[model samples]
Target: MKIRVHVSLKPGVLDPQGRAVHHALEGLGFEGVEDVRVGRSIELDVADNTSDAALTDMCEKLLANTVIENYRIEKVG
Candidate 1:
């Protein structure tokens, strides 16, 4: 099975990388970009029988920092 994990900073957290990209876009003449938030996508190939609970455990344990970030697990195949 194919899986995807989308990790992003939780609301109210400052995103310096995202801010830099937003500033760069404005400098390059891209208008109306009010804000930006950077996130990561992780893809994995696991056994077809892998359960959702196992995937959630992975995210909670190591894939994402639950204190400052949130993660969504997606089954791609």
Candidate 2:
């Protein structure tokens, strides 16, 4: 089995890196560049028998920082 985890900043949090990227894109003359937000995706290959509770624990323990970001986990074959 495979697991895909997406970690992103909360809506109200400020993302300087993302803002910088957005400015750079505009400087490059890219039109319609509304907003940019940076995030991370983690892919895990684990046993098919892995439980949802364990996956949630992994996200809470290591995969994401709960103070500033939110995470979503998806399982794929």
Candidate 3:
């Protein structure tokens, strides 16, 4: 099975990297960008029998910080 994990910073947390990208875009004459928030996506291939609970555990334990970030899981195949 294929799985995907989307990880992002929680609201109210400052995203310095995202801000840097936004600034760079503006400098490059790319306007109209109101705001920018950066995140990451993780893809995994695992046994078909892998339980959702196990995936959640993986996210909670290692994939996501859980303190300043949130994660969403999708079973791709």
Candidate 4:
């Protein structure tokens, strides 16, 4: 089985990295760029029998920082 995780900063959080990218984009003449936010995606291959509880633990411990971000997990064969 394969597990994919997406982690993103909350809507109200300040994203300095994203802001820098946005500024660079504007400087390059890319018009209509409204806002930007940075996030990360992690892919993991685990046994098919891995439990949901264990996956959640992995996200909590290593995949995401819950203090300022939210994460979603998807399982694929």
List TM-score per model, in order: 0.96, 0.95, 0.98, 0.94
Across 12-34, the per-residue lDDT of candidate 4 in tens digits comes to 99999999999999999999999
C-alpha lDDT of candidate 2 relative to the true structure: 0.96
Candidate 2 residue-wise lDDT, 1-77, digit = tens: 99999999999999999999999999999999999999999999989889999999999999999999999998767
Q: Could you list the CA RMSD of all candidates, in the order they appear? A: 0.6, 0.7, 0.5, 0.8
Worst 10 residues of 2 by lDDT: 68-77
Model 4 CA deviation exceeding 4 Å by range = none
Model 1, C-alpha of 6: deviation from truth (Å): 0.5
> Residue 51 deviation, candidate 3, in Å?
0.3
Tens digits of lDDT, candidate 3, 7-44: 99999999999999999999999989999999999999
Find the candidate with the highest TM-score and give its number: 3
Alpha-carbon lDDT, every model: 0.97, 0.96, 0.97, 0.94
Model with the higher lDDT, candidate 2 or 4:
2
User: Lowest-lDDT window of 10 residues in candidate 1?
Assistant: 47-56
